[model samples]
Target: MPTETPRPMRRQILTFAVVGVINTATYYGFYLLFLIALPYLGAHVLAFLLSMTGSFFLNARFTYRTRPTWRKFLLFPLTNAANFLITTAGVYVIVGVLHHGSRFAPLGASMAAIPVTFVVSRWIMVPKAGTA
Candidate 1:
């Protein structure tokens, strides 16, 4: 269960969006930094990892208003598993098939994954009220 009654759905969704914007910037920043040395795919993976760590705390503290715990921290990555897979495949297609620049391609790749990520994140973060 969450530490308190969860915020209303509208509010939670809005908060989630706020956190997501912050996470996106963090992800992009790491991606650009890693791109200096790593290949595109490698940069994406490393950046995803780093950004996800920040996302876990932000989503726990703000969006879900829940305390971070070892179990929740461990579980949080699952929320992004689908997102990661979608973006990875999308990135590969965008770069390899579509011949797009790797720099902005991840942003496009990530768009399709957002709804799924939100659902999984809510399920993991809110626990008891997740499915309501």
Candidate 2:
């Protein structure tokens, strides 16, 4: 007989996906709002930071079901740094190099970073048996 997948893992993945959608929307909204006032890169950075803040809470409460902590909050940016770097570079390349529209470049670039972000975020949010 074939082995079955774990329920907890499945739930976590589903929750993470849901949270990702919400985060993306939140980020895009902020990006659009900021685009009117700032350049595309500036808008992307500000929007990413704001959405990341909201993502911490949502991922903690909904995806990982972990308790929020000052430590985790502070460390959360580390998880996002990879995503930030990748997406920022991607946006730059897509817009500056390829001459894509600034408004939509971030949305296109960010998709590539999502899986890495999810994995890093899960590692950060979920506590080990002895660590929690």
Candidate 3:
């Protein structure tokens, strides 16, 4: 039997919202640890990479529910790269440039990237693979 395509755009957004929450937690956990362990920039970079992998795996399996493909595998890194830039930039501007270390800045900056990353990861980077 043929496979059904993934859900419509609204469903996609909702699915992404759920996954985004999980990914945000994963990213923040590592971010705080690395922020203390390493240099601010270094920690952000390393933690972002680690969390990106985790998010990709979870997003592939749970959020999008698409088949694994060589294309998706390769594109994951690119998607992460985009996410990293946005995340890192946000972190730096808030923590470094703006010096908004008001306790909220850390979480706020990290949270800021969720929507940006989700849109790219879902619509552009991760291939649908004709669903599962």
Candidate 4:
């Protein structure tokens, strides 16, 4: 018997996971740098914005196997907005209500947002056939 092939969704999820690791590393590095000068929340926001920019290109090219376009670049933020909102709220709750350390709050918060972000990003980055 032949081994089963992974479904498109499964493949996408795996790819997204790889890209997410890279994006998270980029974001965390920036966050730590900014943390030296800004509040935790401020650092998170700035880092998120910077990472989302890199994420657009990575997701478009590597994750989705799609060409990068001006249109996709502009729309990419919509996918990230959901992630940003969920992670931001989560960070606030964990750090504020749960009394967690600010340094690790964003990482913990981001885990909850990953599934939602993957779905939204796939929808945005993978366009329908014959559609631009």
Q: Report the number of the highest-lDDT candidate.
A: 1
| True-vs-predicted CA distance for residue 37, candidate 3, Å | 1.6
Cα lDDT tens digits for candidate 3, 12-98: 678777877777777677867877868777766776777777777777777777776667766777656666676677877887888
TM-score of candidate 4 versus the correct structure, residues matched by position: 0.89
Relative to the unseen true structure, what is the C-alpha lDDT of residue 32 in candidate 1, on a scale of 0 to 100? 93
Q: Per-prediction TM-score, please? A: 0.93, 0.92, 0.74, 0.89
lDDT of 2 by residue, 52-79 (tens): 9999999999989999999999989987
lDDT of 1 by residue, 24-81 (tens): 9999999999999999999999999999999999999988889999999999999999
lDDT of 1 at 119: 91
Off by over 4 Å in 4: 1-6, 129-132
Candidate 4 per-residue C-alpha lDDT over 1-132 given as tens digits, one digit per residue, 9 for 90 to 100: 997746876787888999999999999999999999999899999999999999999888888999989988999999888899999999899988999899999998898889888877877888672253
Cα error, residue 32 of model 2, in Å, equals 0.4
Clashing pairs in 3: none
lDDT of 3: 0.69
List of clashing residue pairs for candidate 2: none
Total colliding residue pairs, candidate 2: 0
By TM-score, is 2 or 3 better?
A: 2
What is the full ranking by TM-score, best candidate first?
1, 2, 4, 3
- Greater lDDT among 3 and 4 belongs to 4
